[model samples]
Target: MSEDTTQDSAGFATRARIDTSRPHSARFWNYFIGGKDNYEVDRELGDRIKEIFPGLVDVAVTSRHFLGRAVRHLAGEQGIRQFLDIGTGLPTADNTHEVAQRVAPDARIVYVDNDPIVLTHANALLTSTPEGRTAYLDADLHDPEAVLRAAAGTLDLSRPVGLMILNTLGHVADHQQAQGLVRTLMAGLAPGSHLVICDGTATSEGMIAASEAYNASGAVPYYVRSVEEITGLFDGLELVEPGVVRVPEWRPEEADDAGSGAPVDAYCGVGRKA
Candidate 1:
């Protein structure tokens, strides 16, 4: 279970220096979501963390559901056709392109991730409706400028774009830097663009224990911030209804048997850049 060295046939190339020895957060998340893009190290860490906080699995799955709902809302209700999804994890069910294209077949999306495993799974992400287009960009979250530049090749930056950053900000240990990154990325988009964010929070002892155990692992550390810190990410934007609540509580579809009020150890929201 080494790092994936496979090239993306979709024309995205990762910069050299991707270390396979250490588990990556994207791959670990892929493992949790029942995807085969992760290495043994990721699975081992994921399992260890799950043992400490079993609810993490629910958080991962529900965060994905939140992504679907948010994308659908933007594409369906808001009629947003372009999406710039930074920190795009491994390809999984109901990805941004899938949900957006389902709602509006002509939607275009650019997915940004630097993980080699995610690069290997980039083909699955390349799928798009005949009327729509999807592209993958191998870039780091820390380099939001490069991400926006590469994304501009696929998306029209002047138009409204849905910026999806699901469960990826925790990698930035510095809270101010993380907020700055979000603000920088949002600043590049047009007035009507939206920011969709969700991340694991330091809400409970079990979650804290899990974060500690994960940081102790060889993988890069991910810090769980307080709920207020999470909310601060959306400063200056108009929040959608039921703002910044638990992932499962966000405007869930009725068919989703998962109750809207159920508590999950993660928080999420969608904000419009007014």
Candidate 2:
């Protein structure tokens, strides 16, 4: 646990080197959520986006809360014990594994991300309780088979799993590609598996402007899609209670102030595979 390593008590360390000059999506999000794991360039881009759309920070916070609530519902009410969290950003509060394991001690989680920074913090993402297990996969969503194959090492595919795609689909700009990717991933899971999706929507002019600014920032361009397109991703699945609503409206916990408020430009839904 020195400057040379990010090793947890289990002697795991991040192998991906950090590049501070270029802005990264994971670090920028971590910054918005009030974490210190961001660089100056990331803050600069965030500040610029905030100036364009002040509500974006609200979207980030509320979207994260939606992930927590969705996971809680899947683990507690649905009795799901496995989770596949793709595009797992830097370890923050209420991560998929932490929240799932809190409800069911033996819950198993597999986190996949293509970002080097995210992989660099793999140690933090891999920390798990004795009763449960967690693992980080250095993989991409474009290849769903590879991801599922790698996830098998930690999770049981035969059982129901809560597949979480929170705020990550935007990174794939192509609409058809994104939908196909989701379909492929869901197809691999057994029947009764659940799908959780939360992504920024193109519902407001301010959000559109902010997205343009972010896309031009030299980082990966994230496309904010329409509500119909977002909901289309769950075509084959049965949506849960408050289906495909704003992130803040997705079954907020009593303590979740941001989630209980008015709608942001982000929408989310929890759907069960029939």
Candidate 3:
């Protein structure tokens, strides 16, 4: 299905214009994950960055795994029935709704993203269980208040909501602002609400170099913050077991040790708002 071409109050298309002339974060990431939604320009930049950091593919793939595991834990163990997935990237396998609904068929989800391409591909994101509901909103991350208000139409703000902000905060250049955005969103949710965050870290030189190259691509820049800074986002919340560890290291279900000694370039954690 294609994106809805509906116009917003601003008279501009709610979905982002498909500017194949430049690389977009969603499409670039899509390219990294081996999805066919990206363009030639995105593929070119993705290849260039891969040359700088071959492990990026690992980071991207591992981060996605982290998302799946977090959603499963929330749905299966925590009994979470609602999700607010901001900066929802290109629709890939095992999305938040897919994972959550699989465990709890009545899980409701609201996905927010400003990317027009993603908006166009929103049909892929609209899938939901017969007992649940799913909706997409074209909005920016900087405006968390608007995001919450829009999401409230589909999610119950007075109940526990799992806010997922995976691989998206880096777009906000100001660390403090990013934290503030998160805090503002969490403040709107009721107690027992959960926050699941995962983003790339500046743990390796190669990853840092790749980030730099991507920043130079004229697209929005993404910052790879330190682990301490990433952990700081959950200051007032209760972290789950093995708090704020590498993405692949976050509660590995199997003992094969795919992440035991390996240093992943991303950090993730699940926290509950008290």
TM for candidate 3 is 0.93
lDDT (10s digit) by residue, model 2, range 139-175:
9999999999999999999999899998899999899
* Candidate 2 accuracy as TM-score: 0.93
| Tens digit of per-residue lDDT, candidate 1, span 1-274 | 3334343333244424556677788888888878887778888888888788888888888888888889888998999999988888878788899889989999999999887667767889999999999999889889888888899998999999999998889999999999999999999999999999999999999999999898888788889999999999999999999999988889988655453344688999999998
1 or 2: which has the higher lDDT? 2
Model 2, position 156, has a per-residue lDDT of 93
The candidate with the higher TM-score, 1 or 3, is: 3
RMSD, model 2, all Cα superposed? Answer: 3.4
lDDT of each: 0.87, 0.89, 0.89
Query: Model 3 over residues 11-104: C-alpha lDDT tens digits?
Result: 3554335677888999999887879988888999999987888888888878888888899999989989999999999999889999999999
Model 3 ranges with Cα > 4 A deviation = 1-16, 255-261
**Model 2 pairs in collision:** none
Which runs of model 2 end up more than 4 angstroms from their true locations?
A: 1-17, 259-262
